[model samples]
Target: MSDPRVAEHMPLLSKKWDTDVAKKFIASKEQRWARDGLGHWAFLVDGRYVGWGGFQKEGDEWDFGLVLRPDAFGLGLRITREAIEFAIADDRIPFVTFLLPPSRKNLSALQRLGARHFGEVNYDGARFLRYRLETR
Candidate 1:
């Protein structure tokens, strides 16, 4: 999350990485898993951690998020397809919503995955383009 290229599309990342912050972030994701029965997962390549993201409950909707290291950006679509396939088989998720920063210019991958841009939204003081994909 400290990569400028990555942060460019993340509006809410306001702090630098630190041991405490890492612990807190991991704790939060674990808490979400315990509370929601599912949460983000770490992705690895060649036995090395590359990124982390998954479904997060926002109100009554399940929002999907996928963040990868700059070097691992090319794996996004493959990871997304796998994640969506999981969503399709899971009854809890009927649809998935994506909130992407307006700075993101290439969203064709999402469109290719059957996600459609329906509108925009203001989330935690950041404006984002909203996309929806039916998981059913």
Candidate 2:
């Protein structure tokens, strides 16, 4: 997608997140995952920008984040899973972390994806449930 479109639609899709926390994340690029040579990719379905999923360094470990439009939730996960596989194939990131909110809805999905909760931390005023992806 064009940068202009991405810039324009980001706020709209972020609204679907329905939380100020996610909105804050969308507003700041620095907070989202970005790394040299291996960065986050925006997920576009049917030509519309839906969300982003990617990896970045987090305190000695590589962490991943996925933010998707509510309407595109199902497909977003599908694409994100593919992105994770690609990241694994690169071999630069031996493990991936996901910082999720301590909510049943979020925990259930992470558990289904094989993410194991190993710790917790307070970041940006929100307490996050930390999950790690073990690589073979």
CA lDDT of every candidate: 0.92, 0.66
Q: Which ten residues in a row have the lowest lDDT in candidate 2?
A: 5-14
Off by over 4 Å in 2: 1-35
Per-structure clash totals for the candidates: 0, 0
Best by lDDT: 1
- Write candidate 1's Cα lDDT for 1-136 as tens digits: 8789988888988779678888998999999999999899999888988899999998888899999999999999998999999999999999999999999999999999999997999998889999999987
**lDDT of prediction 1:** 0.92
Report RMSD (Å) for each prediction in the order shown.
1.0, 7.1
> After superposing candidate 1, which stretches have Cα over 4 Å from the reference?
none
Highest TM-score model number: 1
Score residue 83 of candidate 1 by CA lDDT.
92
Deviation of model 1 at 88, angstroms: 0.2
Q: TM-score for each prediction?
A: 0.96, 0.68
